[model samples]
Target: MSATHARKKPFLRLATAAVAMVAALGMAACSGGASTSSSSSSSAQVGDRSPEQIKEAGEIVIGIFSDKAPFGYIDADGKPAGYDVVYGDRIAADLGVTAKYVPVDAAARTEVLASNKVDITLANFTVTPERAEKVDFANPYFKVSLGVVSPTSAEITDVSQLAGKTLIVTKGTTAEAYFEANHPEVKLQKYDQYSDAYQALEDGRGDAFSTDNTEVIAWAIQHPGFSVGIKSLGETSYIAAAVKKGNTALLDWLNNQLVELGQENFFHKDYEQTLAPVYGDAATPDDLVVEGGVDTTSTN
Candidate 1:
């Protein structure tokens, strides 16, 4: 199988089963305007310097997903290669620093950044109020919507159909929080890693799997027997790089970089070059693909 095909096949089977369960149990419940504790009364203090200062430090370590395909993953040669990895390398190169890749899972992203294990987190993290309280987010570079996937044999159609069903989701993802607040009737099967939750779904553990629509669509395309039931369930949001709280200088630099890249349609080009093969004609407009800058204060 081709690399993309190999990467998506397994996820498709797993997602299909998990999504079915979510439908049966009901969608997750949603809480309006809920807030979490901030790291400090004042924004967490971080070093104030331009991008040049960070580069002069020799290397910029970026925390990235190690198993999620097309975002960040180890290639056949055992080197990190993915959309996030490509972006991280470009940022490092532009700053004249060596890019040191630190493999991180979903749950460890914030902790790694907080502890200074990595200078920045380029791990496809969704921007949410809960997370914003802990880490400073740069301008958003990409946007993705939530989607549900089910097996060919299942009858799930919309999010409402997920009443009282069991759904498998990767822990620490926006999908988890979204479902938890919106579909309280649905029982969630959470896993620390995507691979593990996906495996559980394949083993006849859940009814359906929930995640970004882009990811589900890619997986469905690779697996012939499965299909995405709810293509666009709700609001779409941008995915941004995470920096330590109160890192205004670094955050500002990243924001400027994003704005420049947006003006040149660099993110669109990256999507077309890296994501088009798997997504093909299914890709949406450039506006949906590129979200410009981050809005840290915005709740909606």
Candidate 2:
């Protein structure tokens, strides 16, 4: 676990135990796979990997979260597993290449792409104007807003309740930026990983934890003592895969793939398989999932 990266391995069919394992192990990072093309050498100043180059290499390197569950996380078999992992697999399969997962933190999503360390980032990355300037975002596949969870005994039901209390947030997330810009009175405690942010909340180091509403809802359901009192805060945003700036070939490929897959309602099916079970009756697909590349609700 001290190593920064977990070696690549194929996901197993029986991955039900991965959630508990990832929770226990604190989301182990996965190492980047070797590039097959000279243009892809991480040591060199390279452009994003094109679809042809990836297919030629027989693998596509993807950046994803190794800690956040339902969306992205390491499975029991110690491989990348979760909704994004499943989607990444589909992307690779369609392109006739293997998926090489590189576990990433929220803050590192763009860095990995900018350095050509990862070809695509499917790490629950929300689209923002600032990030769009640094990376090219494909059409959105998911959407969300901010939400806050706190101990049920003293639940934070409203933003006004956070008057003098500390709020835990993962670094580089919309939640951190939103509070920093909108609510200066709220004390902020930041962690680089969602796992650590939740740990701070559990330890009573913060009055509440905030992040994507979808994530807080899932987490609150799993933890008996916590409740997501502020279910939705901030503007509705879309999550999409991102590539290095100006990587039009890869970006276009991703956008087209999303549209083609949308024709079959692929994302909704993905929800049934991965998210539905986790959410149970607490949530529904319509509340979240964006099918194909279309995001009717997106203001961005």
Candidate 3:
């Protein structure tokens, strides 16, 4: 489809289809609204429990990306591993439960939490005011800015250079909204996953891919010839964990947990385990880690 036509109407349809995957899983799992379970625990339900209830259950299911690396992804052993997963492990441990992770994409992470498909989400979730209206966010845990990655051949050094080029972005990401509102001259090709957007860039189907500065930088370092040419392009933002709106008990517990974790430099440990091996000295802890709700970047 032409970019303009897709932008005018069909983009929402595609975004909905791509992110509302839990609904699809529900359809495949059982007859209408009937319950299902894993051997270890029951399926999650929306806002049905308090923190005490969740702790009693002995397991907390979390939604996280299985494709985006450094934050969340599948490891060589085919298990979820990354900064988010490592932090999730700590969350579960603090609550005296085991952590079970469900795959999520940027577009669907909030929906999964709202539907009770997961108790919490740590998929590099940014704390925008619009999202805060839909779900409650914990204290900010990481700071980020928009970044654009293009092949050195394209030489896209700044936002202005995007004038007539196509920039690939993930559905439901801030980058998609940024280009639409601020750089309407640039054509956008939105995909469901970051991996897909990056693949489009690799295949020469899109001139560049834009997302969180931290992520694209790590990706560029791991690959070759591509670099994060435009870092800090849009309003600075923060990433945080989220829960269903009004889930106060769980939200409060998470906030307290985050404070304690910060006191211990917990995210630094997570970075070492999940990020350092790939990033080496390319990124310092301060570059991505936000502690104790301290990163108060304006989301307005």
CA lDDT of each prediction against the hidden true structure? 0.71, 0.81, 0.76
Worst 10 residues of 3 by lDDT: 32-41
Best by lDDT: 2
Model 1 lDDT vs. the true structure?
0.71
Candidate 3 lDDT by residue in tens digits, 174-224: 888888989999999999977678778889998889999888887776556
Name the regions of candidate 1 deviating beyond 4 angstroms: 1-50, 285-287, 291-300
Question: What TM-score quantifies how close candidate 1 is to the native fold?
Answer: 0.80
Clashing pairs in 3: none
TM-scores for the candidates: 0.80, 0.87, 0.84
- Comparing candidate 1 with candidate 2, which one achieves the higher lDDT? 2
Q: Tens digit of lDDT per residue, candidate 2, span 89-134?
A: 9999999988877777899889999887778899999999999999
Best model per TM-score? 2
lDDT of 2: 0.81
TM-score of 3: 0.84
lDDT measured at residue 294 in model 2 versus the true structure, 0 to 100: 85
Error of 1 at 231 (Å): 1.0
